[model samples]
Target chain A: MMMQRRLTTLFALALLSFVAVASSPPSSRVVADSVYAIPMLTLRDQQGQLFDFASLRGKPRLVGMFYGSCQMACPLEIEYLKHLQRVVAAGSGKSISVLLVSFDPARDDLAMLRKVAGEHHVWPPAFRLARTERGDEGMLAGVLGIAYRQLPGGGFSHNVRVSLLDAQGRIVAATDASGRPAPAFLRSVDEALKNP
Target chain B: MISRQLALIPMLMLPFAGKAADYVPIPAGQFESALAIAGHAAKLRLAAFSMRSEPVTNAEFLVFVRQHPEWQRGQVPSLLAGANYLRQWQRPLEPGESVLPDQPVTQVSWFAARAYCGSEQARLPNWYEWEYVGAADATRADARRDPVRNQDLLSAIEGTSGHLPGVIGTRPANVYGVRDLNRLLWEWTGDYAAMFPNPDARVPGSVANLALCSGSALAFADKNQYALMMRVAALSALRPADTAPRVGFRCVREPKRK
Candidate 1:
């Protein structure tokens, strides 16, 4: 009788362990093709809240890289993105999340991120200005087709590139983010938003 | 006590077991880069750092992937590495017989190179650091002005195409004690894309049209620096995820901050 009782308890334990293993977070099941699979990146947003870059998964969003101290092109990039957000919303009646990561992590502290967010009137849960607190943001930039270099002077020479990613963190489209959004890029964004 | 001392033999041999340990120190200096751009100064003041004497070989990288399986071919994220990442390898964990163990590892993405460097507490050298070291020959630093040496290097580069890269250290070490910087294979710089050569810098709004800041357009300082220009061109053509059979990388270790 005791042996049977022990066997039942062991079987229950095995089933419980199996359930626990199956219920683990989906992070372990990261897709090999997704951008989030390039090692976990921890970031501190404009509001100074620490979050994993991978946590931004499960929602299609726009991503770009900029430095807070950038004078000409970066500010223009912010305005251009704002215009893009407004257009996407007016056409689809749905808001798109935007993440602007800073490539100059040495200078883009929490205060600088918050300042940039305030200067552009962009806020969290919709538009977030974040800096890398732990991992290499250069890897992130490389994946998104953004390039930056610190010039001999205090300023930086960089290209403004923004990417539209699906909920699976796959880049669906990209734009130089210069003047106006390309029609084809807009169409891709629309398709992604619709499916997401 | 004698037996206990004998048991320490394996631990002593561990440090010399891998080929990844030969790093030579490079002195800091203000060097003129060939691809100087407008608005950005051509002269770069670099700090002292240690650079790997030779590029990482296939055998060393295979060991690296074995320890870090996430970086192995077919397991790495496609966004970080392309379809050709380590395609020369026989398998994800094996380099096979055809892929020589001593040959400098090619077909590796920049991300993978950076990761391998990070494992060794180093990173890919910036372009200026690379240029400074590459300007050196066997005896003299800044040998770019030597026409004979330039022609010889140009010939070597021309001979490299459509052929397998030779083993590392085939040539004598440069003045910095570094080998294979200019000849064997093209290498990845930490900021290659930043050196994008806008075709017509004289044209107004061309820099702005590309959305590159600082009004900088890459202009070669010396027109005769064709070898260096070819290196820059090769690096500029590659995306971070893309890899070529002729491109490999060496790592640098910056001085620790106080």
Candidate 2:
């Protein structure tokens, strides 16, 4: 009977240790378990809404990066995303959130962002155009495997990348879809929305 | 006299104090870079800044990890660091026997390096800034014109390719009193990604092909400077979260206004 009581005490001590380990702070929890799960970044959208980027984890998102004054692939990138959005809605019968964060925070202010959105016919609620004040746009670009360089003429040279993030904010798939919708990328978007 | 003597005590203890970082002033100037801007060999006007005299050491990084436990090995998220981040450390907080206390801390991701610099209210130097400072020798600010100096730098790069990096500041300081810019290890720059646009982006898909074809091609102003070209190539190949055995970092700060 005494041995049985000792085992019960040991079990209780083990349980307490487990609880203590599990209750560590959120920072210790490794919130960015995947590239899409990058830590919360506060950004101002075209609509002037201060959005918490981390809060979008529960919903599937189509994410890309662009600039307001980009005269090259950025326009095609927007059109490709718009095409993907329509394809995903038709394929999965669910509208996915599309987010394009600007790399040119110096020029892509609220007025310019709003103008770009209107030109692209991207209205918020389904589409969001955002910019960061703290120069972390480079950090985001790094995470998404996008590379951009500012030219001497105030234009930029950058790669085209569109990533499909799952409901948990982990990248399901990404593609170099410039001017045309990549079939595999559209299928991945449909799959994510269907599962979510 | 007694008060002056007491003041010397604190100054003497300053090196042993917990503050491990030391900054040396780099005067701003117009310098010609090996990389061209806007399809022309334009001189860059660099801002005055202060640079760490040496790379961050293992012992110093240990103190950093202790204070910010989130950056500790195995505790850092995979998204911010690769599997080999701080893999050489003996434990989460210890640098162990394999890693010497004075050796430059390598196998650090760009994200980790940025965070470490952030802790000290500094940032990583841009590629242009790094290239400008790296142009110096022990006597001259611009040593690329000297063939002997160029050969010596090439030999140094070849000699240190396979081996572990030596202790920081073991080599002589440059003209600006900065140490280990070329002799020790390749470094992470703030604008490393901006140096080389991905080749895939130049393909004919959208207007990007026309916009970036000539300006963004892999063209270097001084192609014969193999050491500088190799550094650019090595840095451009890495992602921000990726870590390498031979890559380390130092921090830079804007000069305080008088």
Candidate 3:
């Protein structure tokens, strides 16, 4: 009888303990979710065709920001992207995908962005241009993983970044055009391609 | 500690991260600098950084100039005249775009640039720091070249393609965790004397005055000599007296103010 009573008491303690543990939030020691759940954007090019980022999953992507009228940084950006392209192609004979998103969507209309697109020789999957709207810009901005703030003076301030989405559509790393020094971005993309 | 508290007493009157404008960093080349510019609503803060690997951008400068028009007229602090090379006060382009919103803000005097920094709650960087980042020869020189964008980029309105609309906030940033330090426009620095040929005259009146020099000593002794001549040439380029269509500026924030 005593033994039975002891067992019952032990069982009650175990149940209480389990409840106590489960009731509380997960402890810091517990393995947590990954830090980055980088998102992919859904966009349409100047042609108004559906541009789904999910389709580009599985390879490293390079994105450049500029509008048609950008005199200073845009040209340099395009120059460096092309330079990065040749260097990567020369080394691996693999062509990388480049995206040009016009922050000035109002002026960089579909036709205008397309003209720039055609000028860049962008077709199907090689290179592309995207025009965004102020209303849906958040969605586009969210996927690119950058935040933009419009200044009172009609200018904008945004976190300037190029996110390299892995094949799984996870952002592996982000780099600045000037920050990577060419070799790093080229080597990284090539490396990401091979290992992936 | 007491003085610091006194400084904060005035700040206590202001809101936290008060309505300063936001700024995005253009990425620099190579391993990114851990430094970040935090933009919480209107306030922009340069988190403590080891060094800025790139010069400031035209877009960033435009914010400063617009907030402080006095900079446009060159009524700002300077130990010497034209200490900071502010070349132009610019108007926009063409029939509709006369304000040149997309062009880099130019014609900023060093004094003006400094005032802009102060307004942003930041400071212009010392010449050593500015030169170190802007002049460093890194592994990559700007290598990307899109022929179409290049040929068509110039303001050749009334040409085949007419004009390409000016764009802001859309260029790829550099790797040093900086944006558009080069090719976009020239950056102003706090170190004018060290940068110009006339080191003696370049010294700010604040520093020179501390040493106790008279007005005669401060004047440009000669308009001759290559040094003086170069000073004038650079001055023409750097002074805020003239506003150019192409000039722009970047700003720096000094932590732990003196």
DockQ for each candidate? Answer: 0.38, 0.33, 0.01
Candidate 2: residue A67 Cα off by (Å) = 2.2
Ten-residue region with minimum lDDT total, candidate 2 chain B: B206-215
lDDT of 2 at B84: 88
- Candidate achieving higher DockQ, 2 or 3: 2
Better of 1 and 3 by DockQ: 1
Docking quality tier of model 3: incorrect
DockQ score of the complex predicted as candidate 1: 0.38
Query: What tens-digit string does per-residue lDDT give for candidate 2 at A1-196?
Result: 9999999999999999988888755433335655544545778888998877776666778888999998777888888778878877877788988899998888889999999999999978899999985536666777887777665456776787778887766778887766567677777877888787
Question: Candidate 2 on B141-183: residue-level lDDT in tens?
Answer: 9988888877888888888774568877667899999999987
TM-score for each model: 0.86, 0.84, 0.34
TM-score of chain A of each: 0.86, 0.80, 0.65
TM-score of chain B of each: 0.84, 0.86, 0.43
Better of 2 and 3 by TM-score: 2
lDDT of 2: 0.79
Model 2 bad stretches (over 4 Å): A1-32, A36-39, B1-16, B37-42, B198-218
Best by TM-score: 1
Q: Where does candidate 1 clash, by residue pair?
A: none
User: How many clashing residue pairs appear in each of the predictions shown?
Assistant: 0, 0, 55
lDDT of 1 by residue, A113-150 (tens): 98889999999888989999887887888888777777
Give candidate 3 misplaced runs (Cα > 4 Å).
A1-41, A133-135, A139-147, A151-153, B1-258
